[model samples]
Every structure is written in C-alpha cells, then in structure tokens.
Target: MTAAPHRPPGAPTADGTEIEGRLDEAVRAVRAPDAVFALSQDGRRTVRCGGTAPPPPVPRDRLRYELGSASKPYTGLLLAELVRSGVVCGADPAVVHLGPGRPHPRRSAITLTHLITHTSGLPPLPRDFYRQGLPHWSTNPYAGYPAERVVRAFLRSRPAHRPGTRWRYSNFGASVLGHALAAATATPWEELLTERILEPLGLAATALAPAGRPDTDATGHRADGTTPVPPLLIGGFQAAGAVRATPHDLLSFLEAHLRPDGTPLDGALRTVQRPVLRRGLGHRHVHTLTWFRHPTDHGPMYFHAGATSGQQAFLGFRPDTATALAAVSTRRHTGRDAFVATAYGLLASLPPLDRE
Candidate 1:
C-alpha cells in the first residue's frame, strides 16, 4: 500500500491536475474502458474521467454506472426514513407487512432491523436462485425471480440459524426487506425509494438500472474489458443490487451522509451510520445499519461497493475530513480486478483535508 498523499496545509483542496492524475493512474492500472472518479471535500467537489472507451457525444459526467449491492445503503436509508415517519419500526416482524397467514419460517422473530443489518440468518440468495438463474447466470441471473416469487420463497424456506443470531451477508434478506417496506407503505419498492431517499437527496440521476436515462448511460463490459454486456435486470432483488447513477450524483449522495444537518434525511443519515452489529473474528469489525464501518487514525470510515455483470462501483466517505468519493468502471469485477482495490486505497489514503 502506498502512503497517503501529504496535502500542504491550508490548501483548500486537491487541484484539478492532481485529481486527474489519480484517476488516470487507476484507469491504467485496471485497464478500464471507461472510468470516472468524483471527490467531495468541505463543500468543494471535483470529478475526473479517464479511460479508453469511446467517449459519448455527451459530457462524461452525465453517464450513469450500475451500483450493484451498493444500493443496499439507500434501502437502509429508506427503512430509517420510514421508521422516523412512524410508518414502520425496526422491531416490527417481517410478517407484519409480508401479508398475514403466509406463515414465515422465522415468524415474528425476523425483524426489519435484522434484515437490514444482515443478521436475519437468511442465505445469500433464494433457494431456487441457482435453478432459475443458471440459464442466464452470466448475463442476468436475477431476471426471472419476481417479487412475488421472492416473498413466497421466504415464507416457505427455513432458516439455517435463528433470526438475528448470525452475521451473514444475504441478498435474499435485502430483497425481503424491500418488499416488506413496500407492503407497509402500500407502495412499490422503486416508488418508495424514490419518494423517501432519492428525491430528498436530490439524486436525480440515480435510478434502478435498465430504466435509467438511456441517452447517456455508460455501457458495461465483460472482464475482458471489451465485450459489452446487457444491463442487469434484477426482478425482485431490486433492493439488493439494482441502483445506478452518474459519478456526480453518487458523490452527492455520500456528501449528504458526511454533512447532513438540515436536510430532510438528517436523522436517517445519522441513523444509518450508527453501529448496529459487530462481526468477524473476535468481533473486531463493525457494521452500521447500512454501511461497513472501520476505525482509522483520522476517524471512522464508512463505505459500500457493488458489481454487476459488466460494471463495478465504490462509494465511501471520511466524516472527519468531510471527504467523500465515488468511483465507477465499465469493466466487471474479477479476482484480479484492481478497480475496487485502487478505488478503496484512494479513499483510505486521502489526506485529511480542511473541514471548514
């Protein structure tokens, strides 16, 4: 790992050239066809783009990138907003909104809190996920599993462990939470998210994939970084991994989390960052309602990342420095993919800038 770049004291922010250099370096390291990097610090924001992909006629900043499971935080925020509005509570059982008489395996034991926190003891995907997804596993694994199927599976499937007794990252749990929230509010999952989180945060460019603005969306690539892949169409797992946004909008979302004093979601923003559970050996790591939390010498850092069939994205921020970052690439993530590592290293090593 390289040392954090030293910023000259009193420097307002990293200049454009410096930011461009960082972006270009990562683009080369990962050999991404298209990449964008956005930074927000102490009310100042900058975005840089570099890659070999043929630039669209429109400005690069206008292009949207898929944000796989990174969308979970937004779902978490929606839950918090609903809770603050008294439409639902974290302690409420999943069955409360999952339609009565379905007879969930966990019944009242699996609460919304458990679902969002990844402690619901649910598996990573539905039992039939492989059976249904195998045909289109590479292109669109979740295409066939509709919301109705997901809910039904949950009611009939048995949990390996008791609710809230384990810490397993479950896409299935996230999907169920989205549907439950929708049921409680009597709205569709997309509408509930748009009304509660996206609209309030002014994330106009952020929307579920395959439905975003077509004119300027970024084309995703296979691991080869050349072959194009269709947009991922996650039927029922929308909450688990279906969000996308331009680099600018993604950065804006993280900035709101860093500094959310008077915003409509101030309370909810703070709520998502509160430590909700501890996992890992000796419980050394931390997880908030929405984000993965890690302590640093400067302060705590919150971050989430995601990957689709042909694209990958990372979102993170350091509250102490009022620094937030959004990184996106057209190439899919692989074991050797340096996109995630480079993006994360950049965030972890950003100089603690002036918070004024």
Candidate 2:
C-alpha cells in the first residue's frame, strides 16, 4: 500500500487537469489495477495516478514498477558511455568481451552497433530458453537461466542471416551485450549501471529486482485484476528486461535524455539518439542506439515500451518539444490493451514548444 498524496493528480493548472483526466481515462480503458502517468515538459513535470482502491488518490511517487525491455535503453546508454569514454568502441566485436569461446565465423561482423541496433541476427531469445523456461513460461520464464548457461547457448547459436544485414529484435543479443559490458568493465551490470548512470542521475529509486526498497514495490496483476503474479526475475537475461523504478525516477531519466548537454553522460546520451539503423517497410522505421526514432512534426520522437508477465511500461520523449513521458501499469499487457497507444497518443498530442 502507498501513502497519502501530497498534491492532487497532476500539477495545479489547466494542462495538469487535462493530464489527470486523460490518464484516468487511459488507465480505465485498459482496466489496469494500478497505473501512473508522468510527463516532463521543458523541465516542468506533472504526474497522475489512478486505478482500484486504495484509489486514485494514492501517493504517486512511492510505487516501483517493473520496466521490462525498457531496460534495454539503459544498457544501450552504457554501451555508448563506454564507447565515448574509450572503454570500448561501437565497432568492437561483441565476442571481444563475451569471455573465451570458440568464435563464430561471423563473430567479427557482429559489432556493438549491430547488437544494440538489433542487427546482430541473433534470435529473440537464447536457443535453450524455451527448454529452461518451459515450466515457468507463464509466470517468469527467465528466472533460472544463469549467465554460464546463456554464454554456452550463445556460443552454439546459428543465425540464419549474417550479422548487421537484418533487423531482428533479440533479447539474447541484448542480454549478451549486457554481459559483454560487465565483462569489459569487470563489474556486474547492475553495479556498473548504478555507478555510471543511476547514481549520477540521482535515480535513487531505480534498481534491479530484490534490491531497493521492497515496501515500495508494486504488485503485478493479471488481466482479471484479481490474480497477482510474482516478481519477474530474469537472472542473466537481466539487461534484456529486469529494471524497475518509480514513475518519478523514470520521468527524471527521460528528462535527462531530453536535456543531456551538461550531464556526465551527455556524450553517451546524445550518442543513443543518433539514428543507427533504418528498417520496416521501405526502410521507414528508424532505430537509434537505444530508442525507436519516429518522425513527428516536432523533430523526432524517441521511445520504447516494455512488459513483463504482469506489468507494462511506456517511455518516450520528443527533444524538439522538450517533453518526456513515463507511463506504467501493474497489469500485464494484452493484445487489445490501449495502455501503450494511449500513452503514445498523449505524448504525440503535445505541440512543439519553443526551444532555447
């Protein structure tokens, strides 16, 4: 349970009121048990919360929700930071830091850029994932797949296409990238992320599962809104989908990306936004190192959405409008759920504001 709210939903303004109403409608539309909507515009922020009781008036900042694949962007940023700091280069082979293994013939072609851009030709998950995850498939599939297992599986992986020639989303590739970064720095991914990104950004409420404050963790629920699901523990596949945080902390993260000029990771922040690959029909969709780049009247909208067995999150920002959004729900995503579309629509609805 959360504490009492210090302020009403959203900020005390016309725009704030609108945000509150929109968020309420969005949450209800999806039948989310609990949800939070956070927006940061030119550094100003508004937050709205809703769902079943303890009710919509519950404190917005205390609850931490699983971020799922949205964690990839953080891994992407770490890669960029390492590159910018000369710790590694985007062109470096992923196998260089993946520890000793019989190198794949195509290993040299799969660079950090390919891995982060989803051009590595790796499958969506490790070859052995289903075998290991079968029992826990519905609740928490990645729970027991350790790093050694992941490494062994990767060494045996045979992609149908050559690396960097195809754009295929791969949790395996992302997870390996996380392992590669950890290997390169001789530090665990969680610690490296905390020291390099989270701590610097003052994101005290963000961390890997079973860490941070347990009391603030949000309960994940199925579509029924009655059945609760256990926390998702991704084990070695953590980098692919294990990060969690309060809406306030996630909004701060987007704000940093929206305005990265003076930060310690400014170089890396800017690096993640530079278009890296273009795909989709006629090559219309664009991907940056960390986010999906979609053209809008207001420059480009960079965003990512992720979900676990029982929670969903959407993160997006438009630098031209100086706006960022972080929306999250405790309910698992269903095909018909409007949570993501609604969040994207809300951000898209905001007009471009004058920038300095």
Could you say which candidate leads in TM-score?
A: 1
Q: Which stretches of candidate 1 lie over 4 Å from their true place?
A: 1-17, 100-107, 212-214, 354-356
RMSD (Å) of each candidate, 1 decimal: 4.1, 6.2
TM per candidate? 0.92, 0.91
lDDT of 1 by residue, 1-356 (tens): 12343344564455556766776677677778888888887767778787777876577778888899999999999999899989999999888889644555674588999998888888999888898898887688898999999998877667788898888999999999999999998998888899899999999988885654447678888888889888889999998998988888998899888877878999899899999888888887999999998876557889998998888999999876677989888888889888888888888777654333
Candidates' C-alpha lDDT: 0.84, 0.80
Please write out the lDDT profile of model 2 over residues 122-202, one tens digit for every residue: 899876788879888668889889887887776677766899888889998898888888888999888998998899888
Candidate 2, poorest ten consecutive residues by summed lDDT: 1-10
lDDT score of model 2?
0.80
After the best TM-score superposition of candidate 2, give how far the Cα of residue 177 lies from its true spot, in angstroms.
Answer: 0.3
Instruction: Let me know the TM-score candidate 2 reaches against the reference structure.
Output: 0.91
Write out the backbone clash pairs for model 1. Answer: none
TM-score of candidate 1 against the unseen true structure: 0.92
Error of 2 at 34 (Å): 0.4
Q: Candidate 2, which segments miss by more than 4 Å at Cα?
A: 1-14, 53-60, 211-214, 352-356
